[model samples]
Target: MHLSIPPGNMKGTMEGEASPELKLEGDIPARYVMPQQDRPSAAAGVAPIPVVDLGRLSRPDADGGAVEEEAKLRWALETWGFFMITNHGIEASLMDAMMNASKEFFGQPTEEKQKYNNIIDGKRFRLEGYRSELLQSEGQTLDWSCRLSLQVEPEGERSFHLWPKYPKSLRDVLLQYASRTKIIKDCIMRALANLLELDEDYFINRTTTRARALARLGYYPPCPRPDLVLGFKPHYDGGALSILFIEENVGGLQVLRNGKWYNVLAKPCTLLINIAECIEIMSNGIFKSPPHRVLTNAEKERTSVAIFYGVDVETVVEPAPGLLDEKRLARFKKIKAEDYYGTVFEHFRQGKRLIDTLII
Candidate 1:
């Protein structure tokens, strides 16, 4: 199903009345300024989240690495629900090509970029092509970033019209990127099933069959008032999982764990995986989905490619039957995948948790 951007989310909030483009200049406009209490501070400054080696995890059990790797995956999932992977097998040339395509697309003239405007038929607002954050209130503070979002999976569902063609290699490069990540997604899903003692393909069929994959390429330019604005607000992802490639040298991503926020730093060769609310529900609270946000850079611009994956809009979402027993009960109520998406998008705009209303 095509999930339209909610009523108040699009329209005149960022770009002039037509689309959600964020036109930034000298000092940021008043609407983009965040409340003082929400400003960013110095990062926690250490190795914040665990870094998992995918190569070891993919090894044969007899090699003495898979066992230990599985244990580490369990720890990362249970604790932070976020981690970076090394030796993930996506070639450096392909990774570089993807980022370069993103840079070239965003570097185009505004009018050139508008050809893929996300607003459809000048009425409904959607999440493909060029877009900005959703506004829950009329005068809501804005995120400091702009993005190009496109649906990539279930080939039949893809809107090729929304995909950029200016970069020449953009379409092919993204297709290859998505293809490679699909393999990793399968590998991890089986590992998760193994950890839970369910069939190794348990998560595979539930998510991959008709899943929707959205590739969001984000651009966060250097902000004049980095302390007064935010690149993104704190919210848990609504999908099952997300694999991200950020501008490696620049620091902007952070995750909230316990009572504080920690930096999620990584190199160009590594990609970060974040568990989302759906996974938390599917795992019956065994896995965590931490709230994360991006801070604007003061001296340089930052960019990221985040692909969100989830069950088809028609699937049913709830704790797995195998996960529920006499001692452990369902912590979340059952909801259709479409309604789950609606609720999650609304909660994101309102800056709240979907689980708060879902908990039993």
Candidate 2:
């Protein structure tokens, strides 16, 4: 089914030509404001998250480097469900180009951005487009960011018409970045399968050729009262995995670990990788899908691009055969990717979460 936004709705209050409501003239609007307890704080004195070096893993085990790297990867997935990786093989120049292209697109005038609004041709749900907020109910809280989401892989699925034309370089750069990141993702997946004692190609072979890949670019404008709004709500990812690239100087991403929030410091040319709910299920809960959120900065604007990797929507997601045992029975029922995603979106609209529903 296709859904389109009305022409009158083109005036976005979030990232485009800011409507009066989008501006903070008085006290922050109660709807946009977050509860005090949900606010973010500094993670001073907290232990930093582990950083995995892919280059080391690529080396032969004669020096024991590969052994140590594999252990780190296992611990990161089993414990934090996320990690940072350097020497990931993506060219530094390409990373910079991708980031620059994103900034240029968001910096455009509201009218130009509105042209690619999530609803295309005024009648279809072109998921690959722009959106200021994902409001599902009256007076729902709005995120303090503008986003451009597009499918980058499984090229046939992309709607090139919706891709931003103003940046010109955005498409080419993103396509290249996606190709490189896929290599990194495949390496990680192979390592994961080996870690589980399954054939190295288990995951690579199981994942359909038409697996869906989406790149979601987020632009957070400086907020007058950052404490009152959230850049993104706290939740776990619904896909199998996500690789995130954040602005170097503007830091606001936080992950909830052991009941405390820890700020994720931005590292130069490193991508943050995290397992998603589907991976958690596939591993029978051995790997976690940690909950995380984005905070808004009072003075600094921030931008992040997240590439979500997942199986085809119709593929059935279930615990891997090799991981299932009498002692470790399946904890989740087999669910189709499309159904899981649908549930997630429905719950998100109601300010709910899909985590609980995944457990048997």
Candidate 3:
């Protein structure tokens, strides 16, 4: 696998107004096809991503076990940048309910799901509801999936009208699930700060004021020619971190490591955690943000619920001074969080890493 960054296409070049689900036949569309040289490969027998027991490090009566677990967490961040965590304190039942809510919403009739369409006036794209990624260029290869996105943080700024109403239980279940994830997010942030020997509130403080989070529910339908299309393109996330609830027994997510792609097998009851771009900058390159993507399934449909967490959009994101010293200098330039948010979709569409531009 390789990472490339090219200037992306602009709006008004898409082939259609509605998502491709309306056009699904057994055959893949020409626009959805990738170059033959860039098709996906099977993982075969490679090892899956790491799994960590996060609860050990957060135990109130933490002992030597905490010290050991902390080291594991640090290594995972510095090397893998992705891991599945168990015992982080969120309830299993709530997780199940959240997954069900996403399925319920996407399973609705087209007219019903259209009530909260992310495209307003059939032109502008809003991040608050059901939609597919915009094709900034006519030749852009499309993903084989649709999604529902909702702002789950900065509660005051959320657009409630875009929130779904058909499921009836969706709104309430999503709220509870978001609240619980916030607690886990804070805990991990504090853990990172403590590991770096900085103030425990270093990360949490930035997020408390203007931080933003979005819950993206992805629905990847079965494809006839799975090799011809991708469920998601290859790119690392552009936020601080992301927590994911992927459907077990269905395989799709894959992470790139050592120039080879490895399938991320799902565990029955673990929540996957991915360290993103901003966190790598904050760690002064001590932590890595791995590039990952999803594969289209030939027989089974895949669904996942993920919440992406980021610092305040207006704040300038840079490495912590404490992480720098006379021996080590900054490796990246300071960039406004809002800038990444603004250009992220275009970057993803073009198979580029926005953070690569910030590398010093």
> TM-scores for all candidates?
0.90, 0.90, 0.90
Task: Evaluate candidate 2 by giving its C-alpha RMSD to the native, one decimal.
Answer: 3.8
Candidate 3 or 2, higher lDDT: 3
lDDT for 348 (candidate 3)? 69
> For model 3, how does the per-residue alpha-carbon lDDT over 132-155 read when each residue is reduced to its tens digit?
666566556767777889998898
Q: How much lDDT does each candidate structure score?
A: 0.79, 0.77, 0.78
Ranked by lDDT, the better of candidates 1 and 2 is: 1
Q: Provide the global lDDT of candidate 1 against the true structure.
A: 0.79
- Residue lDDT tens for model 1, 157-185: 89997788899999999999998988888
Global CA lDDT of candidate 3, please?
Answer: 0.78
Task: State which candidate has the highest lDDT.
Answer: 1
Worst lDDT window (10 residues) for model 3? 1-10
TM-score of structure candidate 3: 0.90
For model 2, residues 12-46, the per-residue Cα lDDT tens digits are: 23432333444343545455777677766654233
